[model samples]
Target: MRKSDYRKLGGIVILLVLWWLLAYALNRHFLFPSPFAVGKVMLCQLQNTAFYQAIIMTLSRCVIGFVISYGTALVLALVTGHMKWLRDYLAPLITLLKSVPNISFILLILIWFNREISVMIIVFFVLFPSFYSSFTNGFDAIDQSLREVMILYPQSLWRQIVKVELPLLKPYLAASYESGIGLAFKVGVMAEILGQVPDGIGKKLQWSYLNIEMAEVFAWTIWLIILLVLLEHGLRLLWKKRKE
Candidate 1:
């Protein structure tokens, strides 16, 4: 196997061993469940249709929110990246969003909207700045010489963006998405928890922890990690294909 495969296997083994040791030392399945116990719960959860629905629901919310953020950020970046004065207009708002606490956004939005809408709004707000900064940075890094060359071609600014600038930013956007997906997934789940939205991983986590079902909680966490890893791999594959 490759070095990366060996590394992954070694990490899993070490973590499992540590978990087992911790559980044994604690000697209480309720507080600190063993890996095996969590695995059992995970297996049971896998057999439940509700678990699948929860995963699907959470995934849908995450994707939808990220898509909205991504599209809006790209538009803003395209506009502000070339216009210095406009950056002044948006900078304070973006700074505020970036600086403010996530819980504050969740709480305030929850007051204005229902739980489901609040969760979606929270996800969008949490992720927008990161993606916006990534997009703007990508645009800022475009070569000035290339812009001058495009100027010689007699193409309009719109044509140059479509033909040249956007193409250059493809890799940057792909890299952002490849990493941003995980961040977005985590934040979306947090939103779900704060919003008290049902049929999501966060909701299941809340229920499990409140009922003192540590094993089930850990099982749900493991499932989330598995899902995130799968998504990261999928994004990697997609990025690779786009590069080729």
Candidate 2:
């Protein structure tokens, strides 16, 4: 590693040492577990079959919700982009959805749907507006002169879309995707926690909190952070490849 990388590693070690010292001084497991104890618990949890199941269940819901939101947003953007009148009609409704609190949706969805389904629904609509706005902006940024030329050439819509629209929309699409994934996971997990899904990370988190298992709670929270970081890195790599 480079000197800078080593410096960062040293900084992290220092922070961890401080945290451990603080935990020792506090001497209350309910309040704070030492970093070593947290690490041990985290490792032990990884060996449990339920841990993997929880991860899979949460990931499944998050992935489904993300796909639904992304596709819906794309379709809506296409429709409203091509139809100015429709854009004006739907603008307020989209804005309303965007402005609404995610927790409110979680509670409302729980009332209307099964617990498992509620989390998926919450993630979907919670992320929809962001994707919609990004795509709409991307579509608006399309070059009129190039579009007119394409029209003159009588190119098929698919050709125009693939060659022109996609290139113009690349950045917006990337931004929407990255942002949507993170938001979807967060909101979906929150819904699951509240709705009490039987076998998900969120449910486990709630159980840990209720039982005063502070280490377990921290472990689950750290797991969520790790998932987010990996997903973000994957998206960045994909975007880089696309640019190349």
Candidate 3:
């Protein structure tokens, strides 16, 4: 392994040690379960079908929310990128969406929509501004010289977009996806918990919390961290492969 890998492993080890020490000192299994206890719970959960169902439901919601937000942002950015007046007109609304607290969105959306739809909408609200900003910034940063060259040549609009705009926008889109996917999952789960959706990781967490199953809570949390790390790492690898 590389030196960095070893350092990361060492850090994890230190954290586990600290966690164990704290749990031992507290001597309250229900309040602060040890790593071993949590690990055992995780193992049991892995054997259960419900755990997989919850994961799948949550992942589906996250993906759907991300796709909707990304597509909407891409379309709006493309239109507004060329229309300064429209961009200015939408600026206040974008700022409102970006500035509102996530919990506030969750509460308002819960009132306006059903529980499952509320979760998706909450994810949308949380992610749309960031995606839109990234895309518009990318559009604005595109080289004016290239556009001038295109104008001089007089290519078809589709050709110009395909050959010029999309190529330039790729990095921005990839960056937004990398950053936004995790946030989507987080916000979706939070909405699920607050909305009390029938089945999801958030619902499982709520159930565990209500039952005071601290070990299960810790186990679920560990799974979430692992999934997020795996997802980010997988995306980085895919992006690297695409570049190659």
Candidate 4:
């Protein structure tokens, strides 16, 4: 392993040891289960059909929301990147989206949409503004002379988008994907919890919490961390392969 990887592994080992020590001191499994207990529960959960279903459902919703959000952000960035007035008009709405409490939005959204779709909507809208602005900034940062030259080219718009904008926008998109996926996933789960969407990890968490299944809660939380880490690593690997 590389030096940095080893250092990170050592840090994780220290954190786990501390957690085990704290749980030992507490001597109350109901309040705070030990890491060992959580691991055992997680292993058992792996055998359960419902657990698999919940994870799949949650992942599917997150993927749908993420793709939709990216598409909408791309379109908006293209438009607002070129138009100052449009950017001015949308600034307040983006600010409000960033500022308003998520729960407030979820509650209102539930009144309009079903619980299942509400989670997707919440994830999209919550993450849209951040990514839109980022993409717009990337677009705005291009060399003005290069942009004018590209505009003057007689080639098709789609060709220009594929050959020019995408190449330039790649770095910003990669940065956003690397950084935003975890936040979007976590927020998506929270939305599911608030919306009480059935057959989802968030709903399972809610059920566990109400039943005071602290070990299960810890197990699910651990699973979430593992899932996020795996996804981030997988994306990085795929990105590397694509670049090659």
What TM-score against the true fold does each predicted structure earn?
A: 0.94, 0.92, 0.94, 0.92
Q: Where is the poorest 10-residue window by lDDT in model 2?
A: 155-164
- Model 1 misplaced stretches (Cα beyond 4 Å): none
Clashing pairs in 3: none
What lDDT would candidate 1 get against the real structure? 0.87
- Predictions in order: lDDT: 0.87, 0.88, 0.91, 0.86
**Candidate 3 global Cα RMSD:** 1.5
Q: Write the per-residue lDDT of candidate 2 for residues 65-178, one digit (tens) a residue.
A: 999989898888887876899999989989999899888898999999999888888888898888888899889888789778877887776676777777888888888887
Encode model 1's per-residue lDDT on 116-140: one tens digit a residue. Answer: 7677777789889988988988998
Tens digits of lDDT, candidate 3, 1-244: 9999999999999999999999999999999999999999999999999999999889888889989999999989988987889999999999999999988998999999989788878888899999999999999998889888987999887777778898899999889988998899889888888889977999999999999999999998888888888888998898889879
Candidate 3: where are CA atoms >4 Å away?
Answer: none
lDDT (0-100) at residue 26 of candidate 2? 92
TM-score result, candidate 1: 0.94
**Which pairs clash in model 2?**
none
Error of 4 at 160 (Å): 2.1
Best by lDDT: 3
